[model samples]
Target: MENVSTRRSGQALLVWGLLVVAANLRASLTGVGPLLDQVQADLGLVPAVAGLLNTLPLLTFAALSPLVPRLAARWGAERLLGGALMVLTLGIALRWVPVAAGLFTGTVLIGAGIAVGNVLLPSLIKRDFPTRVGMLTSAYATVMGGVAAVASGVAVPISEVAPGGWYTALGCWVLFALVAVLLWLPQMRAPRRAVQAVRGHRLPWGSGLAWAVTAFMGLQSLGFYVVVTWLPRFLQDNGTSAATAGWLLFLFQAVAVLTSLAVPGVMRRAGDQRVLAAICSAVMFLGYLGLLVAPGAAPLWSVVLGLGGGACLVLALAFIGLRAQDANVAGALSAMAQSIGYLLAAAGPVVFGLLHTVSAGWRVPIVVMCAAAAGQTIVALAAGGGTVRPATGEVPDRVPAPR
Candidate 1:
């Protein structure tokens, strides 16, 4: 009875922590897209150099991800999470401090904070809510996407009205971090052994299917970040007003908020993720087509892309749940996948911009993204087999029964 009560209490804390952390994930990531032009103009950033503002978070996520699990292992997950949130609060606060260097410096700090949160949350979910991983992951992703919608949608209007201008607009998100700080304090205070778990323990990364899962996640993220960083500019190039472009980005995040809830449940039940993967990639392809063929006529298509992309992101996380047979394995695999995968994904926006610089158009980059989608579909088929091979070398799909 005592164990049961303690387990329930831990679960409650886990859910609350997930919600608070999820709300902070995307604010720093997506908040600036709407205000990039304003920042560039105010700070006199070179157009090409301004692109790094969007790229910095991805770079930070990639570079910092491999360190997260080790840090969690050494310090305990709750303390690490709380400490990361402190970094996030400090970072978000710096953005409003009246210097361009502070702006860039703060953005880097925020990205590093978020990267730690990103890697740790999956381990927490795996450790605490093992059976409810899908549910918690879906809820967290939904909350994340919804907050992103609010941030992207409101950032420009907030900037227009704030006396300190875009700096104040960007600073508003620090309050979200502060909320996370308050909620996370108890967890930090909780006994360390209560939450600590062994790290660097997981399934061997030797399986073809495991590698496929990693690549699918990496490729899908590459395409998603490319769109996130460049889509508003893409719309502006086609003569859409800045506010409308921001709202279109909002539409993307908004649709993701819904799909993050719906698609994970569907994939959980359907037992075959291949079809869902195909549908997701298709939606993304068509969304880009809408941008190319008729920018204004069907904004809904872009929303669909958001739905699909958000679902893909959630499902990638879900793969860790569905694929792992235990928490230690899940955390280890999650670290491997995210550490290498984010590094690959980090290249997306920078490469997309370089392509545009050379081709002087979006068409070539669109082709590159489409090819990535095709690759995702193939890997999705392989990983969707719903097989979990433990560290033992047994092959589940093609093995005869043990004699």
Candidate 2:
């Protein structure tokens, strides 16, 4: 029993440390959005193709996510995460090079680096913070969301003030990656214990529940990236200045940070997340309605949307951790969800752009997102029922027939 207590204390440290590393994951991507137009104009990219720039990262995430668990199992999670951070840092630093190929390669590497981190984090929480999975997960996710907001919000202004142009603004995130690498360094060198996960497992990812979780996570993420990548431009098209649109996007992301912090705590206590998911989708619906009908008051509606969307993001991640019974299952589920989810998310900006081009307005895109959100609400309800999976380490002797 005394040994058990000591192990718990060590797990706590690891969980917190992993959270700090995860917090740095999204800043590099979101930080560049406000400066994308500047990049497009300066680099001679077409506006339509500019949307591809945002979607490219998601595509890489989808393609790369499936490999993280295999790498983690063979090399160990700490080593993989630490190595990915180095790759991520190098990728960020390289984005400033003069060649267009550098931009594309750097973006892919960044996505790949983040993909590795994304797959491992939930598994870490499942392994380390089993009891407080929801709260710890929420805390890290909140920090992730907040840092991303700050990066996106300040990118333009910081670029104007910095000497290296927008490259300076984007490159600033390399410091965070360095910090993650520093913190992660100790873990890599530490001796493995019986308690620490040495390998991740393979699961039949095509199962019904897995697919449901994947689609729910993916579709919701699709809506989110769409808004994050294009909402500023949407506002600009609707007559707002670029700076104001960026701030409004900032406001949207800010509210999401708050919900990411609070919603998981509440849902964990509530002991279910279906209602919360539905409510989140509804909030997104209202935000879309406001944006579609009254473009001027986007600040107000953005808060509502961000709140719900952030909640969805946190809950989606929490569910991934909770639904799995062990680090391996968590890692597998995380990979499957992200593989499918990021694919869904990768479609957002490009599809939204295509839809906008056809309709010559934001109305059609808003309508499509609303429909997707409503469908997600139903999936969340099924996922929240606490029946899709049993507790960790208790896989059924025989697989039950699919629903």
Pick by TM-score: which candidate is best?
2
- Listed in order, each prediction's TM-score against the native is 0.90, 0.91
Error of 2 at 311 (Å): 0.5
Model 1 misplacement above 4 A: 1-10, 193-198, 201-205, 289-298, 386-403
Candidates in order have lDDT scores of: 0.76, 0.78
Off by more than 4 A, model 2: 1-12, 193-201, 387-403
Clashes of each: 0, 2
Instruction: Please give, for residues 1-403, the per-residue lDDT of candidate 1 as tens digits.
Output: 9999998887687689879998999877788877888999999999877777777877898888767767887888788889999999998899987678889899999989998888778767776766677778888888887887788778888999988889999988898899999989888887876434425444347767778778877987887788778887887887878778777877887877788888756866775677787777666777766666666654666676786798888878777656665554555566667766888887888888899989999888878887777778778877665544556642222212110
Best by lDDT: 2
lDDT of predicted model 1:
0.76
lDDT of 2 by residue, 1-403 (tens): 9999988876666766787787878998997777777888888988767666677778898998888877887888888888998999889988877456777788888988999888888877777666677887788888898889888877888899988888888887888788888878878887754443426556535467777778778877987898887788888887889778888888888988887877755775675677877778777777778888888887787788897899888878887777665566777788889998999898877788789989988889888887887788878877654434432453432222111
Model 2 collision count: 2
Cα error, residue 155 of model 2, in Å, equals: 1.2
Clashing pairs in model 1, backbone N/Cα/C closer than 3 A: none
